[model samples]
Target: MTRRVSAIYFLPLVLAAGFLCFFLDQKINASAAPAGFENIPGRILGSAGEAVGDTLFLKADAYFHGGETFPNRPPETKEELGREGFVEDERENEKTLPAQPAGDWISRVNHEVRRHGHYHLTKDKQKEMLPFFAAAVKLDPRNVPAILTAAFWLDKSFDRSDAAIEILKQGARDNPEAWEIDAALADIYFYRKKDYARGEFHYADALRKAKSGDLTRFRRIDLTYHLAESLNFEGKRALALEAYREAFSLYDVENQTPLKETIRGKIQSLVVGE
Candidate 1:
């Protein structure tokens, strides 16, 4: 069951879904014993919800179910250790949360799946997990969480730049104000397509129009970096440096390796601020 959600761990679409993975596990565990046989159907329903979420967040071009998610252009680095790589200590702390929290049923499931996914994202199981998320997305289209995830992972999985671009564009239109939609679209235009001009315009537009206090609320640090990269590409060094700092600061406190190092390098090398 956990194996199914962990499949697209490499995809970026999952990032916007944020923090849903942990709760999914709790619900499943709580229902395991059951007051009656009624819990059986609930368990299956929960799994199905997760599957739909996965499909929307993961895409084949973004994540391959096979040995390599990115064949020609490997990520070379990962960020935040990912939902799959979050520390056990962090999971323990979350488990400590007194338990009164509330959200839509699907949200909780995604949370639990994110927490439980770490075990499944290992080098040995990545091949199996890769296809899992795509299938999940297929199960649920209204699931913005899965849709964005599929699109982003597809971006990483090889050479589907065009496909990725289309996903973001469509997503942005479907969900105009969502920070995730804006951020995802910005990333595609700048990073994948290498069209800094268009990317900068979009990021700036998002930053400008994104609902007052909401504009500053970043769902993904990667968005900040991509925005900064676009600024740099546009030769706006001062703003670029600022964007770079915002992204680096957003890194998860427990994050190790790839994101930490890669972000630092981008800051020092790309941003002109001394």
Candidate 2:
């Protein structure tokens, strides 16, 4: 009877020990898993959200450029039209239509169309497009393009600079390493809000991030130029002159002669003024 009692006492302890070991093993296994494995689901959702945003953007663009119609189509041959019994007047009308611009014709046409307001989104369309952008950012806080596009439409189309700033601030928080976010925030602060000091800070931050990251040379030059402009506007001429000279030096003269010259002029102006 004493032996039976001792066996009963040990059963609970045995069960407890087994449970502890199982928990430890699970914990170790989880810790051993690849770091990126934990992030796979988030990345997938982010990509899906980006795709949705891109699709919505394309739809909006198509509606803006005349709904349901392909923007480019090869001209119908005269013989083909003649076979279809085209009247002389119709053929003459077709001939009078301007020839489509060659090479990247679609982009050129879209630009001209928007320039002349031949095809543009209405306020309702703009409003319709905003929700998808918001959804995209919600799914992927680090989606820089979605964030920037959303901010742009909010500020430019809806006249909601405050809303744009709020979204951009959220994006900046979510993507601390994104120089584009800082650059965009700088632009809004400088031009829309006329908060030059804040603009200078963000612009400088953007340049720092850009230099530290793998940003292209052309993009760095643009950022530096804007930074100089912000400094100049804030009456920091000495700093602006330094920035402009740096921007000028960054340019590939063979490919960017005009841009380099423009920066040179700014630097000269600053020097002459001094």
Candidate 3:
């Protein structure tokens, strides 16, 4: 069974021009704040020049459309997929995706991943989504799903590990004791940012939280292995061995033979010369 720390939903695409036109119409016509709201700096007061509202709207457009005038995304060729290290796009070819009007928070988020998830598998297209993801998080800071998805894209697609770290840090602050966020941060620090010290800290915290919280046995095993990997990368071979042993101890007896053997190999490798 595949395990996911964060859940993602997918959707199809629609006519870009029509979609944006409808979205902008709805947003502009939506009720504005009481009168003096215009006096507030950076307010979206409909009296827009290059105000924050307009800027953000334009930014959102770029985010959604990737600056393309047409909603034309050419299907990937077999060779292209191979070169990009991707498999086939398995989604149904539908012209119109579900409607996710602005402020329909959950629906909008669903639209985000469904619209952009496949693009995220590639380098250039994935980088194009940075603004969109950031905007989504800014719109809903407590949305852990959006935070995790965005940070994952930033780190993996754009090679912007620092940006990913910042996003995850905000998520950690908002959702304190969320092992998923901390665990994700630990992975990024260790693998992407190459900040092993910070990785160790977050990994340890994830372990403590996971043990005390309602984390699944599978998730606990997964985190333990990750912690061991971090320790190994930091050259703490002895500590890594201990972590691997603990992980092996936690595996389900009926279905963990392969995992146990893998952990055993890792432990033996660590202790070979010591």
lDDT on C-alpha atoms for all candidate structures? 0.56, 0.71, 0.66
Tell me the tens digit of each residue's lDDT in model 2 across 1-274: 3545587788999999999999985786576322244344334454475566556555544454334223332234555445432222232221232344446978677746742212334556657666666666655666688789889988988989999999898888878888888988998998898898899899899888875456788888887888898899989999999999998888665765777888889999999999
Stretches of candidate 1 off by over 4 Å are 1-118, 122-142, 213-229, 235-274
Candidate 1 per-residue lDDT over residues 1-274, each given as its tens digit: 3555555665655664554666766666776433234334334565575454543344443332222222222222134345453322232112223222367888678545532222223444334443554444334434556557657656765456676666566556545666666666677777667889888777766665566566443444656677787887888888888888888787767777676677788778864445
A best-first ranking of the candidates according to their lDDT comes to: 2, 3, 1
Local error of candidate 3 at residue 56 (angstroms): 12
TM-score of 1: 0.41
Off by over 4 Å in 2: 1-120, 211-213, 255-258
1 against 3, candidate with superior TM-score: 3
Candidate 3 clash pair list: 11-114
What tens digits encode model 3's per-residue C-alpha lDDT throughout 175-261? 786777899999998877788878888988988876455688878887888889888888998898899999988876767467778
lDDT of 1: 0.56
Q: Which candidate is the best by lDDT?
A: 2
Off by over 4 Å in 3: 1-123, 211-214, 256-259, 271-274
Q: RMSD in angstroms, all models?
A: 20.1, 13.1, 18.5
